[model samples]
Target chain A: MSQKIEFENILRRIEEISENSKKIYGAPLIIDPKTGVATWYDQREIKIRFLISIEKIKRFFEALSRGKILATKCVNTGEIMFPPQINCPRDPKNQIEWVEIPNEGELVTWTIIKVKPYSFSHHDDYIVGIAKISNLNINILAWVKCKDPNKLRPGLRVRLNIVKREPENYLIYQLEPLEEC
Target chain B: MRRKVAIVGTGHSIYGVRNDVNLPELAYESIKEAVDEAKIGLDDIDLVVVGNVGGWSSEYLPAIVINEYADLAGKSTFRIEAACATGSAAIKTAVDAIASGEADIALVVGVEKMNESLTPVVVEFIGRSGNYFWEFQNFGLTFPGYYALYATYYMFNYGVKEEDLCLIAVKNHHYASMNPKAHFQRKITVDECMKSRYIAWPLKLYDSCPISDGSASIILASEEIATKITDTPIWIEAIGSASDTSNITRRKDFTGLYAARKAASEAYKKARLDPGEITRHLDLAEVHDCFTIAEIMAYEDLGFAKRGEGVKLIREGQTYIGGLIPVNLSGGLKAKGHPIAATGVGMAVEIARQLWNKIERGRQAPIKNGRGLAHNVGGTGHYAYVTIYSLTKPRG
Candidate 1:
């Protein structure tokens, strides 16, 4: 009962019924099985994939590929920015340096993604969380790896790791409990 | 000096999974009532502000679509979006226009037809609202999941049980049962909320607001025009707005929304009121309750309770009528249905109706001071808008 099918598959079923109804009823309409409400199944679909520019902080991705987490530190104010950026916000003229994010951190908060978005429905119920690396003075948001949900409590010690995400197989950083309780 | 503005007319559509009506049709359901209640023709309006957070809906430009459909095409009009607080943002924009002497009268409409797309698609669209690239692109953060993060931290710090969160939902549903225009008119029990499956851990199906299709409209008038428009004008006492960090990781903490606190303080200051004695000056409040936990946080954010003590307010039923402060008498976003952009305007409409003693029989707050507050938070602390509505005209 916990395992669910992809949302696209369900949408495909709706579209199939919509196609049949169009041929017989002269309009793209489908009745909701639950409420018995008639709705127009749109004929259009949009696929979104953003080409976000990362030219300024390309080094972060470069470090990720090498299994290294990187952050930006303003040389003047000593401000550290995780998910690293180039310019210092407080003083625009201040230069920033890319530095390694400490692997060790404290798990500040976490939540189990029971009902995921359509894009993430294929994966098993996953835990996405935020971790605070005290030494590095940064908090990182990412997938938290754990077998038991109960053990993923706040203030737990965790370590950052770079791994290839499944299905898409792209490089991404994750937080894993240092020692399973 | 800025002129005083008051809510002369208000209209709200029956909220639910409204699959029966299209976008313009849904908006007109409220506009017709508002225009009629204001006793003014559409031509009397100087400007129009439409609040809609549209992505799932079919219309690319809903403001123009609604204007042309409502026969206000030539009027100066523009759409506003502040994630979930779009309605309050629209009202703020119009009030700024009037306060700046830009326009004497304005109409603000908040509408969202989320059910136009399937549930999964709607979830995907909303999940992409915050820090899309850093959060959704990799983390896959749904709206419920985002609040669940706050719920986890809050529960841990406050030693609150999941049952405590369910109480807020139960109370809101009880009120919704009386509100004819609410989404879920049937009251829900704590057991039902507890039994519901988790959308995100710590946040259950019942804890979250449904994807609703609805619209709420409010007509505002400057003091000069307001006097002639209506006798029972709901004055805009004070409005305070603020925003938080886009990324969840960048936020200072997860305990409570700092932005809400700041906005409330600014509003309290402008209103010449104190947060500690909020109940003394106001009869009731309508805080954002997109999720049950959000409502608990709002208790602390709005200074209704001290830190880590908000859960106790719900536990003791202090927020119910005849208690500390009656909240969500309109069923709230929990049961009233949250149509993103429309929720804020609906809050305003609810507060206005509550102040005028026009709410349904059982849920009406006893209007002693003739004042009420509406707390509308956009996204997950992305934006915060606190508006105070009063029956007495504000000091010039």
Candidate 2:
């Protein structure tokens, strides 16, 4: 009953407003059904789709496709960079090389997302965790494939795994508990 | 050498879901009050600094819109953004302008009309505040989810139960009940907070601060002008600001905000007070309580309690009027209403009023030490500002 009412209300409101407007006048007047408040809906709709240039770090995606996580290493300072950047801020002129991240690490923190944002409303509750990879001297953020948060601890041993995400069949990385269940 | 700055006049609008007033009208409410209290005309103002986070609001360029409506247009003005701490950053900008002898009197306004957008859209905007591509893009972490990470970790580490967190909600709401301008003026019980549905694991609905629309303004003057304007001017003794990595993944711990700790240390150092012994010097504080877990962390981060013992302070009623150092007498952002950008400036207005003994009967903190503190954190510890206000003039 709730779903049917919601569908009818949405369709009725959209049609009522759109039928009166011939052209976008930078103003879209729509009365809120819940509050009956007259609200000027923004006619200028912005669709943000960034064509991010990953040409410099193309190897990261290439490595991800082959089930591997990659990090950039500064040749001068030997510092590792996750979310691999092309240029090293510490040593601007120094040469940098892409290196594979070690799989073994420790879970630093984790949270189960009960409420989701508008863009991520479709997905079920998921666990997001941060793992400290000792060799790289940095932490990586990824989904944790765990059932219960009670079993998770700050110093628990975990491993980073590159897997194909379901529904989308996209390459993504996740953290898994290394200890036997 | 730079000149010292002081808050000569401060004004705040009623904070709530203000659907009655438009953006410009809402902003003018505080601006007019501030100007009147300062005994200054529009011509007396040299610069205007506006703090507004505009994604959820209708006006894209609020600084100019507000200036035009207030009839202070054509004067030098600019908007500043530091997430939720935008108000403090705006004040800092105006302070620097006055301190450098560029402007003698500057007006700083912090306003946010969050109710302009729907609740879900606002949630989407706030959730994307931290490292958008990394955090929100994949995981779809809500604002409550970010704090829930700390809530879960703190509860597990310190053995603090969910009731302890609910107690904070009850206390803030109690104070809010007395505050006519508070968003949620009705008192709540721990049982009610416990019964509230979970927005995030371990963080129920009551654990979060409401999304509100409000405006606050303060007129800052140079020491020379401040002394002439008001006999009880609240001096901006010291301000410490710091930033952390954009990515939450890069942070070392989730139990407490590192940026807040760093900012507090810097502020205490400038005030010539020890970071570990700040409670001894301060009369009261208005720390950012955007979430119940945040307030608990602020207690430790601001040196009001030992690490992991913040929950004990809440459980013991140590942050009340007669306790060691009272906090959030203004009902805090939790119950007083967090209008995002308006909150930090609203804290300044509240502290200045507290220093002047102009607050209501029951909520006022005794001004024995003649000092107060305001800790405003932007994003999830991405930026932190610790501002100290004093009754007496600061020495070189």
Pick by DockQ: which candidate is best? 1
Candidate 2 per-residue C-alpha lDDT over B1-396 given as tens digits, one digit per residue, 9 for 90 to 100: 889999988889999988778888889888988999999889999999999998888788999999999999999999999999999999999999999999999999999999887666688899988888767776677788788877877887888899999988998998888877789988899999999988877788898999899999999999999999999989999999999988887777878999999999999988898787889898899999998999999999998889999988999999988988888988999999999989999999999998888898899888998999999999989999999999989999
Error of 2 at A176 (Å): 2.7
List runs of model 1 lying over 4 Å from the truth.
A1-6, A33-36
CAPRI category for model 1: high
Tens-place lDDT per residue, model 1, B1-396, is: 898999999999999988989999999999988888899998899999999999899999999999999999999999999999999999999999999899999999999999888787788899987899899998899999999999999999989988999999999999999999999989888999999999999999999999999999999999989999878899999999999988888888899998899999999999999778888898999999999999999999999999999998999999999999998998899999999888899998899988888888999999999999999999899999999999998885
Location of the lowest summed lDDT over 10 successive residues in candidate 1 chain B:
B115-124
Lowest-sum lDDT 10-residue window in model 2 chain A = A1-10
Model 2: lDDT of residue A123 = 62
Chain B only: TM-score of model 1: 0.99
What is the alpha-carbon lDDT for the whole of candidate 1?
0.91
State residue B324's C-alpha deviation in candidate 2, in Å. 1.0
Per-candidate DockQ vs. reference: 0.81, 0.52
Best by TM-score: 1
